[model samples]
Target chain A: QQPVQSPQAVILREGEDAVINCSSSKALYSVHWYRQKHGEAPVFLMILLKGGEQKGHDKISASFNEKKQQSSLYLTASQLSYSGTYFCGTEPGDYKLSFGAGTTVTVRA
Target chain B: NAGVTQTPKFRILKIGQSMTLQCAQDMNHNYMYWYRQDPGMGLKLIYYSVGAGITDKGEVPNGYNVSRSTTEDFPLRLELAAPSQTSVYFCASRGTGGSGEYYEQYFGPGTRLTVT
Candidate 1:
């Protein structure tokens, strides 16, 4: 089944912070995060494996909780370029990925 | 490496018409997938291939077929298209490894198909 993402949409100002959460009904072997700007393909951000690892890049970071079957993306000091739709794809230890409906984030100056 | 490429960026089809959406990756990835996204919705997998000659069905594979004749190509075919099949199709490929937990995928520009 498709994972559930909270906060269908959010608006933020530059340098602000925001969080997007994804929860799955089934156990997830991994969680992949991506960002897609308007009219563009989704861009890979980071992937959290089963160990409940956390990863970060620039002002963006993500954490996976195996016990809860959930993952969270943390955007700190968000930038205007961060305005886009965020997608979380879950893999149930298989070759296929099931993506969430997505969360739209708009960052303004 | 042109990463992944898909043909016929946009298409319009009538009910019962048949067509194939082509996807190719120059990265020599071992896995390829086809997914469709409806308006304001996430992607749903239609088909996937683990390697050349090994194809499998995903969450939403009905009315679709796939072929992996080579490592660089995986195409999705639709027969007797219906209005419900109208959506933006995406083709993605990822290399092997990563403890099989997470494999970063590279997606093509996507094909916008409209079935009437």
Candidate 2:
């Protein structure tokens, strides 16, 4: 099933913080986060497999909750280069990943 | 090494025309997938293969067909193009699945298909 993401779009200023959440009705084994700029392929940011493991990159991080079947992406001190559409893809079944509708994040100066 | 590659970066097709979107990976991955993304929307799976000669339908498989003739290649075929088939198509590949670990998927730049 497709995961649900909150706040279809978000606007942030430089150095601001924002959070995007994705929830799935079914249990998930892993949650993958990807970002896609205009006219480009989605690039993998990070993957959360084990429950309660938080992965961080630069000013971005993500947390996965196996019990809740949800995941959250945290962006700290957002930069203009961070502007893009973020998608949370969940692996509910074996060998397949389904993505959420996506949340658009626009970081401005 | 090229992870995953897709052909025909852009193509314009007439209604009822047929074409194939080719994909190949040099990572020697056992799993390959085909997905389509509409304007401002998330990607929807079209088809996937776990190994050579093993293919399965995905969420939005209608109007599309796929073949996995080799471990390094998986191609998506549109027998008869339609306006609804117009979208950006992406090809991805990953290693085998079994352990409870998350395998990263490498995606191609994608093919932009337009049906008139």
lDDT of 1 by residue, A13-51 (tens): 999999999999999889999998876788999989999
Q: Which candidate is the best by TM-score?
A: 2
Query: For candidate 2 chain A, which ten residues in a row score worst on lDDT?
Result: A44-53
Provide DockQ values for all models, in the order shown.
Answer: 0.88, 0.88
lDDT of 1 at B106: 96
lDDT score, candidate 2, position B103: 85
Residue B82 lDDT (model 1) = 97
lDDT of 1: 0.93
- Assess each prediction's global lDDT (C-alpha) against the native: 0.93, 0.93
Contacts from the true interface found in each model, as a fraction, amount to: 0.84, 0.75
Off by over 4 Å in 2: none
Candidate 1 colliding pairs: none
Residue-level lDDT of model 2, residues B10-37, one tens digit each, is 9999999999999999999998999999
